[model samples]
Target chain A: MLGLAAVPLIADVIDEPFYTVMFSRMLILSIGAISLNLILGFGGMVSFGHAVYMGIGSYVVGIGTFHAIEDGISWMGNGLIHLTIAVVFSALTALFIGSISLRTRGVYFIMITLAFAQMFYFIAVGNDNYGGDDGLSLYTRSKFYNILDLSNDNSLYYLNFTLLIVFLYFSHRLINSRFGILIRGAKSNEKRMENIGFPVYRYRLVAFVIAGVICGIAGVLSANQTDFVSPAVMHWTRSGDLIIMVVLGGMGTLFGPVIGAVAFLFLEEFLSGITEFWQIIFGPMLVLIAIFGNGGIDGILVRLDKWWQIKK
Target chain B: MNWILLLEQIMNGLQLGVLLFLLAAGLTLIFGIMDLINLAHGSLYMLGAYLAATFTNWTESFFVGLLLTLPACMVLGMLLEIIAIRNIYTRSHLDQVLATFGLILFFNEFVRLLWGPIGLDIQLPEILNGSVELIFGIRYPAFRLAIIAAGIIVAILLYLLVSHTKLGMLIRAGASNRQMISALGVNINLLYTIVFGLGAALAGLAGLMAAPIMTVEIGMGEEILILTLVVIVIGGVGSIRGAFLAALLVGFIDTVGRSFLPDILGFFVTNDVADTAAPAISSMLTYVLMALILAIRPQGLFPPKGV
Candidate 1:
């Protein structure tokens, strides 16, 4: 948390303005990864369609503003309204999808979630009014109630950083709470948990919705950051990317996804700068990580800590 | 409704379903026996199409190009299994998913490096170039008919091989009980290699066949891969007959739904609403079907006998 708080000053000292924007994006993605970690890492639900919430979050802002502009309506200038609608819509959608999808297990669950996400992607692409396959661009950054101007890059960066820290704290609390314990227990063994009289389905469903709503907030941050929304946001590959982030950071560990988001996005930016076919290297690297990286970056850090303690 | 148009649409659906069957067959087999979800299956499909397209350009014969491509893809599949995939069979599904997802990124970029970003258009052979009359006032492309015919023949051959042959017995045995088959002194490792190779070859064939009608491009495998997953899930994983039936069902639903949904929706809604919503609804129909099927029969329509 302190490291994130120091980023702006560190960047200022280094005289790199672009660092703020890049870190802001990374923070938004970290928020999403943290939400995914709640379900995938703790709850044992491999949702291959979690990106839909992010897409929903973005489109809520994009489409709300588009319609507001078309009708000359000023109500959408409120950031709170956008945040509320995005969260509510995403939560409701998650509830509906999770209820149906949670019935199956393993690969079936993976495919169903994936298929539903694709269905939403197609719908978004078919919406010609909302820019369809082309996506929508904002006329202006979302407005606040005379509190903070999102149009300013520094304000936007701080806003994302603050929310990320807030969510991280909330996630920390949630994962250690009694509800969090049940979710984790369910992940380890569902049948046993059920045998012990825990309503695993209800717990899992709630976790799914919570994850979706949290990621939806990240989606809101992303739309403001980019000032655009497109169907591409909900693409299956995006979902895959989120899963990669969670796994890479260290599943079931708080703050691990934050590290994952920074590492992955930085590696991507660095690699793409070097070559057009960067994924050729990135792809094999993922395979190696899965094969050899014991429990992701967090696992490595833990091991290092142990080694350091032993040496001391 | 024009009968000819309807018939043509059905044929289109069949063509799609048959192609999906080829992809799904290998997928279902691999998942059934190995319990490994290979996301890179589509990568192999992409590779086959690219190789076939290049080979056809060089050999000047589509048949020779396809013949050369299949064995090469099989070899590649076995090699991939040995080098990378062997380690993951014992790991969790998440690991399998992530690793294969990586392979997808690699293969997609690799293809782009070789073929450039633009898509390739495979030329149809002279023999199957034109349309043929199928029914009253209905003409379909000869190549499409050939695809359907080939798919059916392959399905039959696959059925016969799995049911009546020594290798098929081992595969079936492996699907149900891998340990017992291995304990009996059969080479499980060699069997796995052969199975993986066969699955890869089937996916490759689907790719090559699909290339002429569709643009052969990077990431093309992924486009159809999700649909194939739906097929195997609805059909019941590990059962070829289930995959075949489900593939055709899904194919017809999707193709027919996309073609005719607007007209059907027009009966209840305004023209503009129908026009806008039809494609979305049609695209969603297969998923809706899968959800409904799964709701009633969580194991799918035709789950393997023992499983």
Candidate 2:
């Protein structure tokens, strides 16, 4: 958290805008990981297609702007309106997908979600208006009601940073509430929770929708940051990346997703800079982590905290 | 719509279905016997294709190259099982997914590193290259017919081994109840390794057959892997018969839909609208079919006995 806060100042001292931009990307991705963690880490719903919501969010922005420019309706391309549509569309799709997907458990659930994501991917690629497989480039960043200039890099970075903090607080409060406990309980043992008179399905669906909405917001921000939205953003591998981030940071921890996003993105930047086939190294590292690092970075930190207390 | 064109499409669909069955057979068996989801099963298929491409170049004989690929893929599959996958059999499905997903990344990059990102072309031998004239003046590629014949033979062999042989009996028993079979003093570990190897061999055969028809490139496994999953899901996991039937159904639906959906849509809507929506809807038909089947029978069309 302290490191996040200090990024802007560090960027200024280094005289490099890259740090701010990179951290902004991390912040947006953290938002995505945090949303995924809500259901996957706490609710035990391993959605292999969670990145679809992100893609939907991005296409909403991309498509809206394309129409606005084509038809010359300036109102259609407004940032707030695009955000609203993204949130609503994503939440509704989540509701439909979750209701069906949550019916099956284990691998069935995983495969069904994956099929839905693939369906959306093919649909996106089939749309010629949105650049088909190539994706659409945004001519202008989304405009607010003149309250803040998104074209300014610093403004966009701070906006993303502020939202990241807000979402962290929201998730923290959410998991502590009574609803969070029920969701977590369902994850650990569904039959037991159902036997106790809890409507497990509804809780799971709500959590699924919430997570989808949050990720959708992240998607909107991601489109703004990149100034482009493509089918590649919603590829199944990106969903895998999100899952990796949550697991690496520590499942069921508030700040774990944030830590994971930073680590993952930085490694990606660092490794890809060195060689083209960076996955050769990253893949084995992921396998080793799954094999050995059960608790992930947060687990290691907790142990360090315990050792410090004992030493004191 | 000419009768010959329709006949050709049906044959193409059947060919695709046969290939899909080869891929899904290993996947379903692994899922049945071990209850592990190996995402990297597709990686094995990719490896087989790459190895076949390399061996074909060396031996200059496609048939010999294929024969060599079978043992190589089987050994690699067993090695993967013993080294990485064995440990995760006891772990959760999520863990298995993550670990295997890692393997996919590793294998894809590894293949890219070796193959240099360029697709390899596998030329058909002289006999299989030409189209065979059928009755009523219809002609079909001999290679496709050979693939279909090979797939059927493998299917029959798999059925015989499962129903007639002791190892096959052990596999069915293991799938039904792992603990009971183990309690009866069966070496479940060895059985698992064999099953994994067999599955790897099957996937490799499919890849080798497909090399001449499709582009042998990186991530080809993933493109087909998802379709194979849809096949298994619709067919019912852990059922070889189910995979066979479902693979054909999905393949026919997909191929036929891609070919005929635009024409069907044009009958109702304007040409422009049909052109735009047809591709999207056509691509989505199989998924829609899977979803419908799932809604009606969550266990799939033909679930294994006692599962």
Candidate 2, residue B206: the lDDT equals: 91
lDDT of 1 by residue, A1-312 (tens): 778777878888899978888999999999999999999988889999999999999998897777677787778756889999999999999998899899999988998899889888988988888898999998766778789999888899999998998899999999999999999999999999999999999999999999999999899889999999999999999999999999999998998899899999999999999999999999999999889887799999999999999999
lDDT of 2 by residue, B1-307 (tens): 7688788888889989999999999999999999999899889989989999999999999989998999999999999999988888988788888899999999999999998899898867899999999778789999998988898898889999989999999999999999999999999999999999999999999999989899999999998999999999999999999999999998899998988888889999999999899999998898888888887788899999998
| Model 1 bad stretches (over 4 Å) | A12-15
Q: List lDDT for all candidates, in order.
A: 0.92, 0.91
Q: Which residues of candidate 2, in runs, are more than 4 Å off? A: none
lDDT, residue A83, candidate 1: 95
Q: Which CAPRI quality tier does the interface of model 2 achieve?
A: medium
Cα lDDT for residue B287, candidate 1: 85
User: Model 1 over residues B80-101: C-alpha lDDT tens digits?
Assistant: 9999998888888899999999
